[model samples]
Target: MTQTRRAIVLLSGGLDSATCLAIARNMGFESYALSVAYGQRHAAELTASKRVAEALGAREHRLAMVNLGQFGGSALTDPTIAIPEDGGDGGIPVTYVPARNTVMLSIALGWAEVLGAQDIFVGVNAVDYSGYPDCRPEYIQAFEAMANLATKAGVEGARMTIHAPLIKLSKAEIIALGTRLGVDYGMTVTCYQADDQGRACGRCEACRLRRAGFQAAGLDDPTPYQIPER
Candidate 1:
């Protein structure tokens, strides 16, 4: 009998990562959902990630806390800067956490090594992302190349891979794909400046983009927000 291949998906509890987890399951990989609590403003997303993992039937769902607060350059971890409310038309927004993807991917690689999983899936998109350099396709490719060389599994001749299924997909397409995968958007969270109760501020850049995606897809966003009612 053939065993299912294992995949470690970096589930951020947001729409994209939750969709990626579902995608990994659909692709016949035994799902292991991993989340990081890296001192982001919207820590509530981690709770959503846990829900998504259970909903998606992941074999394991783990949340590891690492204080990236020491790296205070980004708005996500730094309280000094505010999360962007308007479109970030300027250079890399203040919310661009430096080396965030690098750090997360490194940790995911470590977990995948221990789990003996050859595939690590991350839901990073360039098209809809608010100009996060790490979300770019080339960044993912470079990380994949470096990860394969950095891990013991790769050094031992086991081929390790990083999967970014939504790298090229637009926000609307991502929403559509997640819908097709039986993903419950209500269980996912995407607001970067959500209140502690998970109600979106609806004014932050993340909220704006998420609202746009659902509008473009003609889907009612199930995410709770404070705007429409306010």
Candidate 2:
């Protein structure tokens, strides 16, 4: 019998992340889901992450609590800054958490080394995404290179690959793909300001993009939003 390879998936409990997890499973990897409670304004997605991990059949799910809120530059981490309803006016929006992806991937990399897994999956997209500098292909590539150089396993000649499966995919494409994979989108939360119960605000940038994705995919969005579309 062939041994199943293990993979560490960075599950953010969002649409994209959930899809990434599904993709990893479809590829026959024994997935270990990792979520971070990184001092965001709400824990709604963290709650959703648990549901996603169970539904996706992850071998193990772990949460690392890090207080990124103490740094508090982005609206997600700082309560003082309001989440933009208009999606901002281009450039890197205020929603960009400084070094968030780097920090998260660093954590995932450490876990991967310990687990002896060379693959790490993250759902970072360049298309139909918030303007976060860290979500770019260049950033992902740089991180992959850094991971290979920084890890002891890499020093021992084990190659590490960071997988950003959704990097080039449009939101509509992602939704359609995840739908085919039997992912229940209702269990995921993409709202930047979701309520404690995980109900989306529907006006935030994340909600707008998600709503448009479902529309473009010609599928009904299963998200429960606090505010209905007019």
Candidates' C-alpha lDDT? 0.89, 0.94
lDDT of 2 by residue, 81-155 (tens): 999999578888888889889899999999999999999999999999987888999999999999989999998
Candidate 1 residue runs with Cα over 4 Å from true position = 227-230
What does candidate 1's lDDT look like per residue over 1-230, in tens digits? 99889999999999999999999999999998989999998988998888899999999998888888787998889988888788767688998888888888888898889988999999999888888889988998898888878878998988888899999998999999999999998877788787777788888888888889999999998888765653
TM-score of each: 0.96, 0.97
> C-alpha displacement of 4 in model 1, angstroms?
1.0
lDDT, candidate 1, at 95: 88
Candidate of highest TM-score: 2
Candidate 2 regions exceeding 4 Å error are: 227-230
Error of 2 at 217 (Å): 0.3
